[model samples]
Target: MRSLAPQREETAMHDHRTLGRELDLFDTDPLIGSGLPYWLPDGATVRHTLEEYVRDVERRAGYHHVYSPVLGKRELYEISGHWTHYSDDMFPPMDVGSDQVVLRPSLCPHHALIFRARPRSHRDLPLRIAELGGMYRSELSGVLGGLTRVRSIHLNDAHVFCTPDQVADEATAALDLIRRAHTAMGITPVRHRLSLPAPGGKYVDDPDLWRRSTALLTEVLDRSGLPYETAEGEAAFYGPKIDVQIADRAGRQTTLSTVQVDLHQPQRFDLHHIGPDGARHRPVMIHRSIIGSVERAVAHLIEQHGGAFPAWLAPTQIAVLPVTPDQHDHARALVRRCADLGLRAHLSDARRGTLGARIRQARLVPYQAVLGAREVGDDHLALRLRDGRRLDPAPADQVLAHVKDLVGAHRTDLW
Candidate 1:
């Protein structure tokens, strides 16, 4: 906790855009068009790890993962009200003979179709569907910067369909998941926002629907006892939302996670589940994102940690730098041991630079094992932690156990 202020200062000095280029994490090619950045091998490794973490969390929380199309029929968006409320942010429709398809701007419409694919009963109430999906938004080039504001997004998105009576509980649970995800990634939300529609804002026309959904989320926030501020014109077009806000390097607040209570979408799609009494009833749709977009989340993470990510999240967790050519075989053997222990370890280029320079070069790595001629066996390999602490040579089994425990537990400590 004491390191928070200093770390944020470090983040401000180490903007992700600059680090991305220097670290070879990700980049934008002019041929790929603006607002679309390609992830390098290292960047993809981090993104894949984050996605895996999100999947594990969602699964434990009773959400079933799904894969949906990135393109949807034009009528699909129209039926979901996106055509009317959000078409401006969406790409132009692509014509295919008599029909047209558009790049999806959100996952809910497809998830909604999944819910309606087969008749569901009350037993299936609170059906939670999750996806690490790709979507696109047509942003003006000027507004696009790095990964934070991109056209292509791989989102950590989920939807919960439950009875109206269960909305509050589901929303609370969703908030908990979001908090856990943030903490795992070393992010702290500076504030929580209850986003509502503004005067004459483009929202669902039904007064009762808006009122009910807003009160539901407001009560959940109040019951959770987390202080929040209400923001006008900051909500989704279909409903009000509780946004988890974090400040970026420039100290500008951006929403990273959100839980939105929606009544309009289910109604628009005419979605329903059969009650225990055999009557058709509307199921409330609660849309939530733990870490909204992979690109934006990684952007925040890179800046927040200054690319010195916590042990579990570091793309290359450890670098094995052999001090001399004589120790080359020893270094290769140690890297294999690390791989066997599930650590991402790479042998640094001992051929290119001096040993001291190589150690300094891998500063972003969470751990470094520098094996020299004197350090003959795997059992006596010394460690240099990222925070500049040096560990004396210890038994290889004991050392690997401790390091593996920390990484496996997703901990920050490197002892």
Candidate 2:
């Protein structure tokens, strides 16, 4: 049996409140109410960078981007069966005089509407549609955390509509895309959880479909030779799923992503395509999210790196410091050079304090500081690494090149 004592002890040691405040990432505003986050400028930068990364990956994986309204008609939820099954998680319906609408708690129903918009044929069988949608869920106040649990969430939702014959191939492709994304984000040793419904539980009423779907997912995992564990009673009401878990610094496991094999939604929505025999047939739906939620993933990255972000993800990758007021112009020039090279940089003038004090301040903020000075009767600068090592700066072009290379390499250790 798993002990809850260790979980309580671990929670005490890693206080998210202190980390969130110290890092200036996110904060709860009383005026905004609980479960809502007001991301500071630094936190916003990290969030946007992560979104861009995911968008690029989705585009390369052949997903067509789409946008849906945050509020949907009450009838849509009824058709999707969310009104009956997951209604507790949704916001109360608002009566718009003639019609009732509720804040969206998930993107699946909206994506289904997109599929119903047109008459799809077998040629468009494997239709991949993705959306970075803002969804709302009314959480109990006690469950709210910085970014881990929230009232509003941005999800990287992708739905693959494939014919029954192509379902396995599409599932494999989705898994490949997720693997590539984990690699890009430096999430190592990815673990999978084959989640199924508990026996005689709130699963879809078809026992045969559940058995076949679970077996298919198991075969995929086995063929890939990836280590996984069976998780009973963790599946969605619609179907079984594969949960991707990652460990943090404290060794606490969290679900970072998921790929669910949904066999009910497509049929409920009557999604169909023309088959080779010219007969109408139901298509399979595969729901994949490489990063579970934008806000939650950012929180995980924060704790994983302890707020010292990698070069590519850092808000300020480099800080320029002038040795004296006389070198202020040189420092500003370096900042511009870095900016031109697509690196986030800041200039620290020496008038505020002594050179050593300014360097210490830069270090406190955890940025790579460059100290500009006069050396050997020539204008020169010293590159101060995050580890306190100082190196003679080369030409401006050479410095920019090196910084670009470092960022490209995603070097977390070098500074």
Candidate 3:
């Protein structure tokens, strides 16, 4: 459970909302209503980079990426226990052709259907299905301010349909992936929390199910070798979860990644897989998110890096600035070569001002290829990094190759 600290100015220097505006990452318009921010070109670049990176990671981890409709029939949520237990946070159902349909608040129901779409064998155990898709929440206008709390959320959601025996390993692997992702994005979680069901909350009325789920999550956490707190009443309605908590600029903690053990959804959806004994056996449902909501993740990242993202995630990886119009031809060649390496390198216009001014303009860019008359004659580039480190002049091709290598490897080092 995250303790919400009232939005304060303590450490407001890195507030995502402020940086978001300054960086032109995203914005909200009244015509679009509250809690919905549109991504600018730069923001979209950051988002697309993140989405591709997540897909690549999941592909290597045996996860089958999927796309499901954002709207599902009302009956789907009814059977998934969402209609009965979570309608307060859901949009009202709309009547369409004598059938009620609504925006989906979660992707689990759809993934469950995909799992049940075909009969499976024990060999297919731990079938990982992932989606980075949009879902809606009916949040109060008062609590809606920035990207952190939004109505239209694109979640990095996944489900593993595995046998009970495979639960521990799948959950553990999910945690490792989360850590790897955070490290690459320069994010640090505040702590790990084992979230339990609230005693008198709107949960499925199955005490035995809750107890068993809690014990399983407890055991899994115990094996993690990481210290964590047991948060009462923070578990999802369907099961207990392990939450990776992160703090905002105000020191307010929130969940950024999660892994939950769910048996209730399987029972509700009647999900199963065939076993070696030739019997139909129930499959455990493991829900995990490396970066829960893309919006929230980006918001946290904007604050975490103060709009100066790592090379891989930055909108402009390298900004090529020619010291004067005399060096324009050389700078143009450098820009083209960097683009050939598939980098987002920009050539600064001489009209922008002096070399010092252009360098200051691109201060947030991870790499700056500043070419001067001397470097142009020598066929080398003067490289400046965002961290205030300037490397010795090197051949243009050598510097471009090094930048490409760092971006491909998702490294923040300015070697």
> Cα RMSD for candidate 2?
3.4
Q: Which regions of candidate 1 deviate over 4 angstroms?
A: 1-12
- The Cα error of candidate 1 at residue 410, in Å, is 1.1
How much is the lDDT of residue 249 in candidate 2? 58
Residue pairs clashing in model 3 are none
Looking at model 1, report the run of 10 residues with the lowest lDDT sum.
372-381
lDDT of each: 0.90, 0.78, 0.90
**Backbone clashes (count) for model 3:** 0
Model 2 weakest 10-residue run by lDDT: 372-381
Off by over 4 Å in 3: 1-10
Winner by lDDT between candidate 3 and candidate 2: 3
lDDT of 1 by residue, 1-415 (tens): 4658886667646888888878889999999999999999889889988899899999999999999999999999999999998999999999998999999999999999999999999999899999999999999988999889999999999999999889989999999998888877889999999999998877878889989999999999998999999999999999999999999866889999999999999998999999989899999999999999999999999888888988888888889888878778877888888899988899986797999999989998988988876676544768899899999898766787788998888776676
Task: List CA RMSD, all candidates.
Answer: 3.0, 3.4, 3.1
For all predicted structures, in order, the TM-scores are 0.96, 0.90, 0.96
Residue 176 C-alpha lDDT in model 2: 82
Q: What is the clash count of model 1? A: 0
